[model samples]
Target: MKNASRRQVLQGAIASAIIIGFNPAMRSWVTSASAASEFESLPPLDGILYTDSATRNAAADDFGHLVRRYPSAVLKPGSVEDIVRIVRFARSHKLKVAARGQAHSTYGQPLIEAGIVIDMSSLDTIHTMNAEGAEVDAGVLWSQLLLASLERQLTPPVLTDYIELSVGGTLAVGGIGGRSHRYGVQVDNVLSLQVVTGAGNLETCSRSQNRDLFEAVLAGLGQCGIIVRATVRLIPSAQNSRVFLLFYNDLAALTHDQRWLIAQKRFDYVEGQVVPDASGGWRYMLEAASFYTPPDEPDNSSLLAGLSYTQGTQQIEDKSYFDFANRLAPTVAFLKESGVWFYPHPWLDLFVPATAVDRFVGEIVSDLTLADTGQGPVLLYPVPTDRLRLPLFRVPDEAVVFLFAILRTAPPDASAIAKMLADNRTFFERNRDTGGYRYPIDAVPFSQADWRQHFYPVWGRLVSAKRRYDPDNLLTPSQGIF
Candidate 1:
């Protein structure tokens, strides 16, 4: 009698939802509630399953503020078991599922329409830390891990420019930063992962154990599994960092110097930027940092000895290691306060072959205007291709590749957003022709063919792994990889 009463209530809710004009996809979920066998009740979960408009609406968009796809429900899992149960339920119901971290992606990569959205933030916990590495929940932010690691005088080998991103989020995509030139991207630094496959199985994978799943899950963009926890590589941390800012008027000169610096490994960190000059032209700035303890400091003369940057235009600063790593916090706060953080960001991130970087970047900069770039920074830096080992983390076929990112902000105007998106498509095509690959974080559009081409020789491996781990094709459908 109780089960029948519950079914009646659910049927009433479905009727109301249909009359309210739910979209087709959403209506399917609502109608499914009327099914006697399947819609009796959701499986027991450790966390809350939210169907309220407020929670569902909040999960509808991401950092891009461009696309919006409302999910039927949001799951704030209290435990890893909650995820397992929900995924199993979703698979049984043939519903799509996606795991969201900070929602920092500039596209709809994490959004799922009329499906289940797993909110990973509720599982924020640092499991353990040792001389070897740190094990943390996927919801734990990079900044949180950094502070905790500092207590033991250890740090992750590589960190993204923005430390506030979630661990599972960044590892899903290859986390790259100035330090990546030496230590490789963040995914390359991971020692192991605890993942829930599409089939709802919890498995621990590493290089020696479950090697295929390990490679596919790292930088796999959540196609095959949801990363629940990770054990990442760490190293001894320095007390302070000495940073050098070298200016260059010539594009070729800047790239040349950046390549030489990474090749010689003179600095612990190397990155470059394209900034607008006072005269409405663009100039290059090479930013490098060297780590040191109090007793010993970096010798500026020795570090900058052979650099071809313009003379007398150099600036230097000293900061604690923590401060240096978290430098973007202030800027992020300012953006939020000024209302710029909510603007639409049609960012374009590409990995261009080192051989074509100078010519490719020079042409783009010459044609760009302040309006097109907005208030965001333009980043260009070289990363050694040989150092990146993960199979799914795609890069240009070369000894070195340049990470060129144009983080553009568009006003809420429809025409402006449309224009920027169109420009992105054009830029992507040109970069693709030049042996470059998209970083998959931007707003650029892609089709199945493009994704296949992006994977190229390893496409078969990716397919096989997906078939093995996510047989039902129920994980991360928003990525459109399959």
Candidate 2:
């Protein structure tokens, strides 16, 4: 029922447009418009389809605040049927299609110049929930989904640090955070998906059914199919959580303690960050969390009695699970209000081998100052390799992989953007030489050759999947892999 050809889906859209009073005179103006007018070739459905300048400009960029790619038209689908119609129409006409969810990408991965941009956010719907899992629309934000699930006394096992991103958006790129070390990436926790392929077929896939699609679509970067809906695994929710913060002046000591802590399974969650040390030196802060009932609060002293931390600098806090998960709300609010949130973010994310992390951090941190990174945090953390099972989400061969990120935000001036990109390039080249794998979500100007190198062993499988599911390369034209 979700699959329909272009001609078969026009009635709903036509009816809606008529009800809203479609402007007949605008047809003449649309025809004379830029190449964006090519959208007129497609049949409509129950959605808002337009090529006006306002909508076009709004869909042109993403969170990076760089790379403007104006799509021919933006389609806000009211139902899955509309997506099927729009994609089928684009495939038939050899036009490109990009499925956009929240536009949180640092690069222009979701933008398609002179092509159709499908706004998936309008399809937001959280259908059902249970102890096992919940079936929800891809456009639903992780924060929104978490709130709804908490109401039912359940929650997703793994959540990114920033939950404002869309489910499909993070799933496509392998969502990672502190919990990932224990539960695995968001993509690994999926149960099933309702994907609309480039060929315009609405296929339901899971681990046991349509197995190839199920594997390919996770972290598939919208190259294989557009994930319209997903069944996410959930866990019993806890009422409260105990949080810990430990500081260290030495990188080796911090990373060593992290490895020991994760191996012993001493905490429910573990991660670390690098901040400017008081005496103009870089310091490491280890963050851990434990869930428990209010009646059975954990002994913070017992938990940290053996760990080595900076003398007399340990901190502990207690918060409800909801408040703990949403602790970053204040930071994000400050960024938004400071006007820096709109600045161009030439971000870089990479996974370095645990063995090489010491040297990697040493080289970068030696020259890195707060000013050099646009005052953004230089986040560094370790993750277990066993949790990441998908071949497409590449990582180092070591037992532990360290995630190092340089999240830089700069003014819109050409010189500022150029300087940030230059710094990013230098950092990336050094990391690549050290056998590190780029996360690909950052603003790296990747070449086809670079992408192949990034996915060497699994490159063939990815290509095969792309051909099988999106033979015409009609999806995610901005990723530049095809």
Candidate 3:
């Protein structure tokens, strides 16, 4: 009892010391916020508008488990009106606003200093399934929705690499998963969204309604408006998925098989990742989750004939579709809980056409083999072509190949982390010579000029959209494009 009491007293003393240490600076922050509040009544203001030492501390944080922190204001808007009101305030105050969803980003995308961060967690409400589609508040987690959908034997066609990420979180960026190869991207599955535009107007937009606003918001990256709610398309959930993990020695061989499978629609789900070899080199993780099995029986010779692959057995794991999609939840949670999300993540995702892929991979793999990112699987997946078969989105022509290389920080003795960063740097530099365009990995060394050229013909449409929606470029100041 005495020891427990002593510990409690020590904790209290530490807390009080922290508050005392920042008392002077805390006064200025509170005074500024109070002055801002004085100009007009902003909501109830009862839920606690934090801006002191602790609140200010929350600004420079994320879920990457390993990136350097960038300072930004953390605003927990209690209501939808709060979001609209805050965006307007930020616009008037000449401060940028970034919609922060769970802060799961490994890169500095969520970190914006001297700006307002509109936290979406408070906007949690899952609306019912109606004519338009199911109305889910932007902050709702996908795991919650998956359960509700499964009860009715219905599910959203698309999902993320991990289900713990917020629905709007992944959708804010482009949510890609194994199923994306078949159904389409998470953005493509959305039927409608309730967006709070830059003008502070609450609008419900879809293909049929507010068409321009709808188009801009998809893959919009929280620039045009605050997506307070979304209505996504739904499909019946498959009872079981026959998931198979095939191993391949050669990246080219694995990609070749994957490209063919995706082109011919041979499987319901198709995706691949590269795992480090015994010497820490990377190998292919060719995986698929199909509703049916391959026609060939589970024989050793049949499996041996796989393209340059021999590691994996003809193992088949049967799981419900929902379970399969969220297979990485435990691993994701482990990474987050273990403080691995704090490292700098340089993920280079590119959309390569089928024709260019051969030369693209051939040039890349030959020059620098597999990079040694000491993080999760190095994803190399083929995205569905039907959605963007036309000139709707601006990216490389042909089937989209989503490529990513994560650089995870480790203890000083680990060589894999350093090698990963070095290889990524080399890859980015050589990419200019090889005609590879790294989109989201823009901040590293690529200039805006290269970004424009990379976007090619779609540059006009993108800039036009930005001009139409956010002419002043008040949102996402870090993007630097506007």
* Candidate No. with top TM-score: 1
Model 3 / residue 123 / CA error / Å: 0.9
lDDT of each: 0.89, 0.83, 0.62
Q: Clashes in each model (backbone N, CA, C under 3 Å)? A: 0, 0, 13
lDDT of 2 at 92: 68
Could you tell me the lDDT of residue 432 within candidate 1? 94
Q: In model 1, which regions exceed 4 Å deviation?
A: 1-38
Instruction: Indicate the TM-score of model 2.
Output: 0.92
User: What ordering of candidates by lDDT runs from best to worst?
Assistant: 1, 2, 3
lDDT by residue for model 3 (253-340), tens: 8877887777776667888776666875556677876753234223334333444556544466777677787788777678769866
Candidate RMSDs in Å, in order, are 5.0, 4.6, 6.7
Stretches > 4 Å off in candidate 2? 1-41
Q: Rank the candidates by TM-score, best first.
A: 1, 2, 3
User: What is the C-alpha lDDT profile of model 1 across 1-482, one tens digit per residue?
Assistant: 21124454455345333211123443443333344322335665556666667778999999999999999887778789989988987887788899999999998999999889999988888989999999999999999999999999999999899999999999999999999999999999999999999999999999999999999999999998999999999899999999999999999999999999999999999999999998998999999999999899898899999889999999999999999999999999999999999999999999999999988999999999988988689999999987899999999999999999999999899898888888888989999999999999899989999999999989999999999999999999889998
Model 1 lDDT at residue 452? 98
Candidate 2's residue-wise lDDT over 1-482, tens digit each?
Answer: 23333553454334222222122234321322233423344454676665666777889999998799998777778788888988887786677899899897887889989888998888788999999998999999999999999998898999888888899888888999888888889999999999999889999999899988888888888889999999999999888889999999888898998888888878888888888887887889999998887678788877786788887898889999888888889988999999888888889888989999998987888888876778887788889999888778888888999999988887778887887777777777788887888887898878898889888888999999899999998999899999
